[model samples]
Target: MKYQTKIIEKPADTLTPVGVYLRIRDQFPESLLLESSDYNSDKNSFTFIVAGLLENFKIDKGVLSVNHQKKSIENTETVKNALKDFIAQIHVRQPDKTKQFNGLYGYTGFEAVKYFEDIRFESKPQKDAIPELNYGFYRFIVAINHFNDNMIILENIPDGETSQIESFKNLVTAQKVPQFHFKANNDETS
Candidate 1:
């Protein structure tokens, strides 16, 4: 699938999955973000979660193997890897220490094309007020934690067409992210 990479940085408090999703929505303006489970959910059961989409990618974190003692780390690394592509879209000050620094893997992908065919009201034919959705990934995603306090940084990894890349740049430049302390990789950063 085609993909776009970015670095997404936010205050540790604001770096939740939902926050990441909202930020991407605000930035991309025309992308459908869905999680792996959501992707599998029935049409009537479809629900949106900020982090759901990112979790679908299941990006590799390069950890040797999953261990029961490191379940949290395993989960974090999974999500972190998922967000790696998302993080590659930002620029920040040098980190004093780093954790989960899977640089360059931060990316979002087009999973499926959605078709908002048509809907009918009770009796009368309803005008298709809803916009037709055909382009973009139906399930592009990124990662975030609801209650993380450690400082994190992600640099934007440029991919996709020049216009697409420039558009993302414009969005980032338009609104500056809240400043947070930078740190190098450490086991506790996630």
Candidate 2:
């Protein structure tokens, strides 16, 4: 249930991003996937988007487990408040910047549209979240071309500021998936 973001060396082409996106799709099986224009474009840009209920991320009754982050919605009022806050946050960030903004941007949405609204309006709270919850796990990754002199700036999305999203940031920052970790001995140098 741990969501990770790896900043590997950018591939020579869009093959790596496409591969990653496909791998995620295969893993999720029933996700609402979205590939940025740059992903399908002929340009050498690597941008991919994935959103849907994978195996681990789900919410049942008043309980929710998003990438292993479990929490109860408290009550109907609490759920409403949380949903309001979540929607507000989503609106603050433009959908198009999912890739350009960089790093894993995870959210519970169906498409790039009014997903939470439908949840808030359609589902009637019955001592817990009615109809059970199966929201998409939106994910975004940044492929670094020149990893040497560049740093990932964390200023775009407001999600990083909240304690709720601290785990997401921690996964991306502390536990980065190292792609270029090879040791070279002095004697072995060419």
lDDT of all predictions: 0.32, 0.39
lDDT of 2 by residue, 82-151 (tens): 5444444432334443345443333443321232343343444456233254544344333322223222
Clash count for each candidate, listed in order shown = 29, 2
Alpha-carbon deviation at 130 in model 1, angstroms: 2.3
Task: Give, for candidate 2, the lowest lDDT window spanning 10 residues.
Answer: 145-154
Tens-digit lDDT track for model 1 on 75-158?
434444534543453343323432233222223322111111132233332363231112112222233232333222233232
- Runs of candidate 2 with Cα error greater than 4 angstroms are 1-6, 14-16, 23-33, 38-46, 49-62, 66-69, 76-104, 110-190
lDDT computed for candidate 2: 0.39
- TM agreement with the true structure for every prediction: 0.25, 0.31
